[model samples]
Structures are given as C-alpha cells and as structure tokens.
Target: MKILVYNLKMNLDDTIYDLKKVTSKKIGVSERDFASFKIVKESIDARKKPHINIVYSVMVETDRKIRIPSKGDIRVLEDVLKKPFVYGSIKIRERPVVIGSGPAGLFASLILAQNGYKPLLLERGECVEKRTQIVNSFWAGGKLDEETNVQFGEGGAGTFSDGKLTTRINDKRSEMVLEEFYKSGAPEEILYKAKPHIGTDVLKKVVCNMRKRIIDLGGEVRFNAKVTDFLIKDGKIEGVKVNNYEEIHSQVVVLAIGHSARDTFEVLYNRGVKFVQKPFSIGVRIEHPQELINYAMYGDAAKHPRLGAADYQIFKKFSKRTVYSFCMCPGGVVVGAASEPETVLTNGMSEFARDRENANSALVVSVGPEDFENSHPLAGVEFQRRWERLAFQCGGRNYAAPVQRLGDFINGRVTRKLGSVKPSYTGKTEFSDLNYCLPPYVTDLLKKSIAFFDAKINGFGIEDAVLTGVETRTSSPVRILRDDNLEALDIRGLYPAGEGAGYAGGIVSAAVDGIRIAEKIMETYSNESL
Candidate 1:
C-alpha cells in the first residue's frame, strides 16, 4: 500500500546492490521500535548510457526492526499485484455490442469482457493481419481492396497510421489504456516514451492479442460485419442491422466506426440518425529518405545507433489559418490508402522494427465551414472525393499517389530532377502542378508553411522533399452528435464514442473515451437496475 516513485535507469538488474544503498541506512532498531510503519516516496533517475534519465514507480515496505523486506519478497509482492484486475462492476444485460474493432471499441470490449459482460464486437474491415496483406498488395501492385484497406478494418485507420499514442488527455483511464496496450503485446518501451508509438508492425499483433482476450473472456468478434443501420424504436436504439439484412439485438451499442466510415455514415443518416458537417484537415503525404530526417535532427549524431530515424512535427499560422504536421512516421513508407474506386488517399506507416529506408509526414491544412458549398453532412465527403479524384488524376490515373517536388511547388516552377533526398513511394512520382489536386488557397498556404517550418527543421523545405498527394482523411468531417453522457444526443442507446464522434482526437483519447462511454452505460444500467 506504500506508493513510491523510483526514477532509476531502465537497465538496472542488481536490485540488492542498488537498494542496499538506499535501505542500508539504519534507524534505532532496539525494542523501542514497535513495527514503525512509514513510507518514503523518493525521486530516482536511471540512465540509458550515463546521463539519459529513465524513471519508474516502485513501492517499498519496511518493518520495526528496521529490517527491510528482501528484494525477492518485494519483487514477489510487486509481481503479484501488478496485473491485478480491480473489481469494477457494471450490471448490464448479459451481452452488449460494440461496433468497430478500432482502439476504442477494442479497449471497451476488453474491459467489458473482463468485468463479466459478454460484449459482441463488429468490425467492417478484415482482421489486422489480413488487412495488412491486402493493403500491401495494393501498395505493391496497385490493387485496391475496398473492404480491407487501411481506413476500414479490425484495427481502424490508426492501424495504418503512425500509431501515435501521445494524447492531450491527462486522465487515469488514459494511463490504463497505455498499460493495457503494453499488456496486450505492445512494446513495453511505449509505456514510458515521451511520444510513444506502437509501429504498424507491432500494432497488428497488439490488436490481435486484444481480440483474443475478448474472445477468451466470452466476447464475440465478427469481422467484415458492417452495421448498416441502427434499428431504433420509440426513438431508442433496439439493435443494429448488419449488412442491411441481418439484425442483432442489443440494448447498448458502442459506435466507434472511426473517421473513415463514410459508407456507414450514409447508411445511418438514411436510418434517421442526425449528423452535421465538421472541420477536418486536408493535405498530402510527403516522403523523404530517413537519412534526411536523421541528419536534420541529430546532425553528426545521425549515425548514432541509438537514435534510429527521427520524426518531427512543425506548424505555422497563416492569416488565422493553421498548417501543421499531422502524422510523422520515422523510418516509414508512404502507403496508398484508397477505398473508393477512382480516389487516392495517402497515409504513413512505420514497422515495429522501424528500419525502413524512408521517412514520411503529413503536412496538412485545416478545412472547415468555408469548404462546404452547401449545407449537407455528406458535402464534406464530396469535397474530399473531389480532391481525391484530382489526386488520382495527378498520379496519371494509377494508384501511384500524385507527387510534386517542393522546389516546384514553392518556387512556382516545376522541376524535372531529383535531389539529395529520394522518394520512397512505391508508386510513380510526377512533377506536376499541385493546384490541379489541391485548392489554390490550400496549396498557397502550404507553400508559405514550408518556408515557415524550414526554421524549425532543416532539409524540410529542400528542393527534393517529395509531396505525395491528397492526405485528406485527417479526421472525420461529420460528428455524429452525442450528449454530455456519451450517448447520441437524439438516440439513447446509440453511443458515439470515438474519433468518428468528434469526442476524441487520437488513439489514447479515443480509447479512453470508449472506456468512459462503456462505464457510462454501466452506470445507466446500475441506476436503472438493468
């Protein structure tokens, strides 16, 4: 019960040698002491090499004889309690259903299953491993699989993304999400890194492990089971209609369909669900050699084995409009993420090993109400489609993403040659005018942002840094409205809980919101005696 903070370098193996120095200090150990109980929370710092600091939390216990618990005893206790599943209860109907196997739904299903609720999960896309195979096929030979692509799938769009775990949330549930991820096959190092990421390679296994646990705990996961309609009666959701045919009944439904669920949005809107257009970002995936970024961040230290490849995020305010780096993947490659037949979307992904030859990032501009020509939720989708169409055209009608050299883009002149940094896109690169793909204003803003961001990171605005076209799926452009209690504002059982709901930004916050929504459902049932 004594919580302690131990900031020790991560590689400490000799606990006795290390702790002896701390606990070796003796107090009066005569019969005068009757099991004196006190806990000390001391600050400790560990090292990677000599000066690099790695910190940890440790709990200690001491007795009256001033006798310290043997390191083995402490380790045993810590190990025993470390994975303890607290008795957090929610008396829902024996089974609830979760839509979308993204991080939000996955974590919610895990907790609900652990807490004795046999939740059912539905995912529109294929499993992560299968989805990876399909996505790579498209990346390799330009074959697009609409159902199993990066945007839709067991792991959601985050699977193909940088897997950025950094969130703006400072909540206990967020910490729990990180801890659970570490437990469910994510690298342990992600638990402490300042900007933690579970590279696309590891995220596949991590998601699969979470799915296994859900199944082991009596939950069911149905992949490629698209929920086409929310079956509501008396203005309360009764269940979801899958694939427009089969109906699965459930009193509670967690909709984490993710930002890219455009088809689902259309289906729900027709089913009487209300939504509104919202702001999201639009831009292109820019690919550069990993060495370029490594050189820029570390300079001569770029050759240091410890640093690996570097990633960066830069931003600029252009006349009240903001242009920023959205997803930066180190040692990553630009993957073709197109779902529709004639559209192309670009996303960045790094392997768990992160040993790829290229580095990539999304330099995006915010698209908002101004982009909406008329008042329609799907208007934003149309807007996205238009740009995607142009991007596809920019690529010479192939799956190769449209590419524009920075020197051509910013200098208002097209270049026909390559420079120090090479393009890593498997697709073809065309040095064409970006205006054909992006809005004139958007491309102009981007040109200004490049010069502005140059001061922050070198080699950023270089002539050779490649700009691949149309990274439009920054986030959902429509928010399925939800009330303060997390349920849909108009529909009681319809809980819009994650990125698609406009309630969360990235993986951690989305997962945390999912847990909150699940807990809220449990609370509702508890209050109603359901």
Candidate 2:
C-alpha cells in the first residue's frame, strides 16, 4: 500500500537517523512495514519564532497492508499522471518561428523541437556567453550596448534577476516547467522547496543547457538577429524580416519577445497589431541590511546555521492605489536594466548562495490607464519613459542611478551623508532627491507605505535604508490582444506569449504560457512533413 503523509514536524536540531523508522512511528506502524520513503514537499515553519520547526509532506510505500488512523495526516496515495500531448494532422510547408530567447520562447521552442516541429528561435542580443561578458563590462562602468544589456540578452531580462520560480497561476503545466529546469542544470531543491529559486548565476547555465537541448533536437537558435518587420498578408503572418533584411518565411510565428522590447512594441503597434493599455506598477528599489531582515523574521533563531537568508512580501491597499513589495531578493544587489541609451532603471539580482550583505526589493504603486495623459494604447510606455529619462538626468546622465535615504525621502529633503546601509547597485550611483524623478502622486503614497511596512517588518523603513530610482518594468504596459485560441485577435498565425505579450508575470508563469502556446500550435498543424 502507498500512503501519503502531511504536516510532519521536526525541531531545528532534530536529526533523523532512520527515515523509515520516523515514518513508521508517525503512522503507528513498524519499520519493517515500510518499503520506500520520499519527501514530497519541505518548508520551514518560523511562525512560532524562537521554536522553529521543519514541516514536511512525504510519500511512502508499504510492503504490507496497514490501517491508517481515520483522523490522522496519512492517506491513500492517488496520483494522477498528466495526459500526453497529441499532434494534429494538418501538415504545413514551412517550419514555425519563435521570437526572443526568454523563458517563454525557449520552452516554446523546446516543445516544438521535441515534437519534430524544428522551430527557428531568434534573439535580438548576443549569446549568453558573450552577453555575460558585456554585462560585466557595463557593470564595471564600460559602455552600455543598447542592443544587448541586462534587458535584451540571450536569456532575456530574467537572466539578470533573482530567478524566482514562484507564480500565482494554478496550472498542471507548472510541474512540467519545474521538471525541465531540474533536468537542465537547476538545483534539485527546486523540485520540492516551497519557494524555489535558481538565482542569476545558476539560471544562466540552466538557460544555456535548455538552448543546447533544443538545438540537439534539430531546432535552430540565432542570436543578434532582431526581427525588424513582420510580413502579413490579409492579417495572416507570412514571415519576419531580420535586421532590416534577411527575410525568414514561416506560416506560424510566436512573438515571445520580452518586456523590454520597446522598439519592437512600436513596430507592432504601427503594423496594426491589436494592443490595449494595461495597469502596471512603478517605483524605486529599496535596500536594507539582510541581517536586519533575518532577525525580524526569525527572532531568536536568526543565526541558526540551518536557516539561510530571509525574504518577505508586504502590501498595503489605498483608496485609489496599492503599494507593495515586489521581486524581493533576500541577499541581492540592485542592477542597471536599461535597454535604451540615456535611460536609467533598477532591478534586483541574487546568486545561489544569496550571501550578500544587503537585501533589496521594488517598492512600487499601481498605475492604470486613467493615470496616463491620453487613452493611447502606448501611453503607459510613454509614461514609463518620461520618469526613466528624468531619473537618468537626475543621476547626472552618466548611467548613474539616483538614490536617497529613506528618512530623507520621507521628509522631502536631499540626503547628504551615507548611513549604516550602503547602496549595492552594480553601476555608479548619485545621491539625489528621488521625488524629482517620480510623479507627485506616486511619491506621496510611497511615503505613507513606508510606515505601514515598517510596522510589519520592524526595520523596513529604517533611516539608513536606501531607495534607488526608478523601477518601471514591473510588467508589460501594453497587452497584445489575443483570442481564446491564444492567437492575435486579427492576425492569424501570430501567437503572442510571455511577459512581452502581457500573458505572464514571472519566469515560471511565462514558461508555462510558452508551453501552452506551443501545444496550441501543435494541435493546429502536423509536424510529419515540415
């Protein structure tokens, strides 16, 4: 008999000498009755503070029949396996093309290649190997490559982020996404942890491995090949032109371009692709001491060796706006994410170890179409650009990020001296009034949110906490309208997927969206011939 167990708790210092014995004891059975034991999920329960417990859900196989207590956490194992994908019979003459190399595009192409679709994946930036070098040089104050900075790269903007895999969407495809990541150089812990993260350092290798697998399966990947134009005949995508030349013909095109592709968005809008302004958040990156956050979260167990760095998410609701903490990196640094020249923005990234001294997250407020000057579909883009340009100017127009102390920002005064916490931004930073770069309404709400957050996290609003300006790319400001079939509303064979299309929000969700899109394409066209 196979049995599943839940809510098994152990103290921080407790060590299991024999796992089979533990399971037998928990379920009121003998060790000899156990056939196999496996942990299904594990998480730290710090809600009790000083007395932290490790909670686990495990699956066990028993050699003999056992009577489970009717009210206990044990139950009969009834796992439902996912159904296999079925390919369609309609044959096509040309292979499918996937735009961008982010999580969505990569996974979408992987699905297509595995099923013999032989997709052509295109990226606007250099490959990961060279993209890493360029990003490092830019961090070291070298020239920024507008074509391939942190935003536009082989792995997309997510390559330089904290690489969090947590998402709010409840879909079965999510498990498939995690399995793929694990098979492609990601840590094993990601398979079962409550909140899994690959980190930027490890994620780069994972992405590269996935790309290689797609190629080995007979798919093609091209870097530094920006799609300049989309060929459409009577609202059906026929192909795409690369770099203002080199036309690649394909009947089906997946637009998985990431969120930072402003120029591509403009071209698509001009070409009459349906678009709608979407609500997104914008604000500055807040930095605080990692130790401070740990103490607040873990109390007396802050320094326990078993416990790693701590992370948090807090949000407050207002009458007309909502302020929240986003992309919280426990032990991470702020990074420059500028895809265009003369613009400045901030993002957060952490390594696998997460051993940095300070933690950072985006503290932003929500903005909608009503906030824009006009009802134009691209108004949000213009709104973001306006503040980004102002932030650039405030940072001395040299790629430096504008920063202010939390107290100074609250009091509406210019910060003069450094505090206990220092800014961990990768590029140059300038001390300036963040208010000047942000809208007056946003600044007002942010000031109020600090106190509300400080009450919950203890030192969240400490005087020394650094606030870096401006983080506008919380999500795509423009959502490319799509039909129930996941195709562009009017453009047949033009499928929009991932963050750039406003379909997904994070790495996992975007990858899941990509998988769904690939499945839809397979269902419509047969891969036996092309």
Candidate 3:
C-alpha cells in the first residue's frame, strides 16, 4: 500500500528518524511497519523566522495495512504515474534537425532520440567544457568569444545563471525533467525539494552527462554549427544552412535558439517568417551582502546549517507598470551576459553550495508593445539593443558594467564612490549614473519600488547596496508565431519552440515545452510520414 501525508511538520532540530516517527504516529502504525518512505515535498516554514519549521509531504509504502487518518492532509497517494506516450505511424526519410542546444532543444532531441528518431543537435557555441573556459577568460578581462560566451552556449544562458529549475507551470512532464536531471548527475534532492536548483557548478556536469547520453542513444550533437539559413520550399522546411557554408537536409526542424538569438530572429523575420513583438522586462541587477539577506529572511536564526542561503522575491505595482525581482540568486555573483559586442547585460549565478558573499536579483519593469512606437515585429529587439548600447557607452566602452549605489539611484544623483556592499559583477565594473542607460520612466519606477521593497526585506534599498546596469534579456522580444500543432503558422515542418520563440521562460519550462513538442511530433508522425 502506498500512502501520502501532507503538512507534516518537524522542528528545525528534528532528525530523519523523527520524520519516520511522525509518519508512523500519523498513520496509527508501528515504526517497524514502514517498508520504505520518501519525502515527496519539503518546504521551509519560516513564517516566524527564529522558530522555523520544516513542512513536508511524504510518500510511504508498507506491507502492513495502515489506518487512513480522517484528516484532509492524510490520504492515499494519487496516481501521478506518467501516461505512456503513443507514437504516430507516419514514416520519415531523414533525421530531424534541432537547432540550439538549450534546455528546449536538448530535451526535444533527447525525447526524439529515445524514441528511435535520430536527431542532429546543433549548437552555435562550444560544449560546456570549452564554453566554461571561454566565459572565464572573458570575465577575466579577455576578448569575449562572440559565439561561446554566456548567452550563446551549450546549455544556453541558463548554463551561466543560477541554474534554477523552479517554474510556475503545473505540468506532469516537470517531474520527468527533474528525474532526468537527477539521473544525469544532478543531486537526488532536486527530485523532491520544494524549490529545486542544480546551480551552475553541478548543472554543468548534468548538462554534459545529458549530452553524452543523447549521443550514446544515437543522437548526433555538433558544436559551433550555427543555423544561418533555412531551406524552405513552398512553405515547407527542406533543410538548414550552417555558418553560410554547409547545408543539412531534413523534413523536421526544432528551433530552440534561446532568448538572446537576435541574429537568428532577424534572419527568420527577413525570410518572411511571421513574428510579433512581445512584452519583456528591463532593469538592473542589485546586490547585497549574503549575510544581510540571510538575516532579512531568516532573522536571528540566520545561516543555520540546514537552511543554507536565504532568498527573497519582491513585486510592486506602479502607476504605469509593475516592478519585480527576476532570477534572484542567493549567495551568487552578477555575470556579464552579452552575446553581441559593445553591450552589457547582467545575470546572476551561484554554485551548488551557494556559499558566495552576496545575493543579487534583477529589479526589472515590464515593457509592452506600446512602449516602443515601432509596429515592426522586431522592434522590441531594437529597443533592447538601443538600451544595451547606451549602457555599454556609459560603462566607458569597455566590457565593464555600469553600476550605481541604490541610495544614489533613488536620490536621483550620480554615484561617485563605493560602499560596504561591493558589486559582485564577474566582469569589470565602473561607477556611473544608471540613469544614463535606463529610461527616465524606468529609473523613476525602480526608485519607488526599491523603497517599497526595502520595507519588506531589510537592507534592500541600503545606500551601499550595489546596482549593476542593463539586464535586458529578461526574455525573448519577439514571438515566432506557431499554430496548435506547434509548427510555424505558414511553414510546415518548422517548429518554433522555447524561449527564443517566446514560448517558454527559464530552464524548466523550456525543457517541459521541448518535451511537449517532441511528444506532439511523435504522436503525429512516424515512419509513414516519409
């Protein structure tokens, strides 16, 4: 018999044995009666901070017949077993081509390869191993590798980010994705932790393992093979041109080019592919001492051994727009996430232990189609580029990021010197007026919202807290229009999937979307499609 219990609470000092004892008492059974037990979910109940508790949901399996408590939180476990996928009967002649090895493309190709559909995965950047070296060199004041830097790489932008796996979408495939991560060198805790994350350190290994598994299963992954052009014939995808020199023919193509693939978006738009300007956020990355953050969230019990680093999420509604914290990384550093030259974008990343000195998050404001006067589909792309370039100029035309003091930004004055909270940007940085890069409207709203957020999380708007300029790649600026079948509206066999196509946000949702697309292809086509 399998049983599940929710809302099981344990004190901060409780042990694993205490959890088993609680489970046995709740089910009116002896401790020895339990055969196996696993925590289905675990979350921190830090409402009172110092007296924090761990709330858990556990799945118990035992041979003994246990009494079901007549409470709402305890009951028989529901069947969350994934439904087996049924493949279509259509036959195909050529292998499918997946462009961009981000989470979306990786999962999509993994699914196809698992089902005997050999897929050719192409990434414009090098593998994670080589890509890491390139990114480090760039961070160390070396020339940025245009193709293999933080934004365009083997694992996509998320490779250099916090590697957060949390998403709001409630999908059964999410569990599958997490399980796969666990199987591919990720910590098993990610399978059951309430807010699971692999972090950049562990995530690199997991990504490499996933790639090896895909290749071992007969999928071919090629690095530095950028898809420059699509071979479209009468509204159907025929093949793709790589780096303007080589072409690979295929009836099916998965475009998971990521949110920073500006050039690819332009090429597709120029090729007459339909697109629409989408709303995205722009803002600066703010950093505070990790100890300050831990105290803010955990109070007197800050830095408790089991608690690790603390994180916060803040959202405020302004008259013209809403401000929110994006990609909040606890005990992390701000990274230079630029794909093109002469621009700077900020993102946050942490290691598996999250033992860094600072916490940072993107304080961004939402911008819609109305914000940019241009009605062109790619106008959002240009809007992002314009601000990015301005930020580049503000930072002395070098790779250094423009930064300001939170207090100075709110006071509408230029920052002149440093404070106790030093900036954690990986690349070089310069003190500058962030107002020079961001629009007046955005800066004004950020000032107001920072004040508001400070009330919620102490030290959020402190004078010494550092703010790094221009985090523009919050998401894709254009949506590659697709139909219910997940294919481009006018182009058959051309699937526009993932962030670059404006279909998903972050690593988990992108991977889930990728799995969904792959399933759709499997359900609609087979060997007979040829």
Query: Could you estimate the TM-score for every candidate?
Result: 0.84, 0.98, 0.98
> What's the number of clashes in each of the models?
5, 0, 10
Residue 116's lDDT within candidate 2 is 92
Which parts of model 2 are misplaced by more than 4 Å?
16-20, 69-71, 79-84
Ranking of candidates on lDDT, top first:
2, 3, 1
lDDT (Cα atoms) of all candidates against the true structure: 0.76, 0.92, 0.90
What would the per-residue lDDT of candidate 1 be over residues 1-530, giving only the tens digit for each residue? 23232433332233434443443232223323322222222222311233322233344444432333454223212334445434334445536889998878998888878766778999988988788778878877757887788888988888887788988888979889988999998977676566788888788889999999999988899998988888888878889889889999877899998887888888888877789889998988887778877776666656655556677878888775789988888988887888888887788888766788888888899989778778887788888989999888877787667677888777766557767666777555666667678888788899878767777777778878888888898888888887887788778778887888777888899999889877777666642232
Residue 156 in model 2: lDDT = 88
Candidate 2 residue-wise lDDT, 1-530, digit = tens: 78998888877776654445567788776766667777778789988898898877888887677787889898988767868877887887799999999999999999999989999999999999999999999988999898888988788899999999998999989999999999999998888788899899999999999999999999999999999999998989999999998999988999999888889999999899999999999999999999999998999899898789999999999999999999999899999988788899999999988999999999999999999889999899999999999999999999999999999999988899979999999999999999999999999999988888999999998999999999999999989999988999899999999999999999999999999999999999999897
Worst ten in a row by lDDT for model 1? 39-48
**Candidate 1 ranges beyond 4 A from true positions:** 1-94, 413-415, 426-428, 526-530
In candidate 3, what are the lDDT values of residues 391-449, reduced to their tens digit?
89989999899999988877767788988988989989987899889888888888878
User: How well does candidate 2 score on lDDT at residue 261?
Assistant: 88
- Between which residue pairs do clashes occur in model 2? none
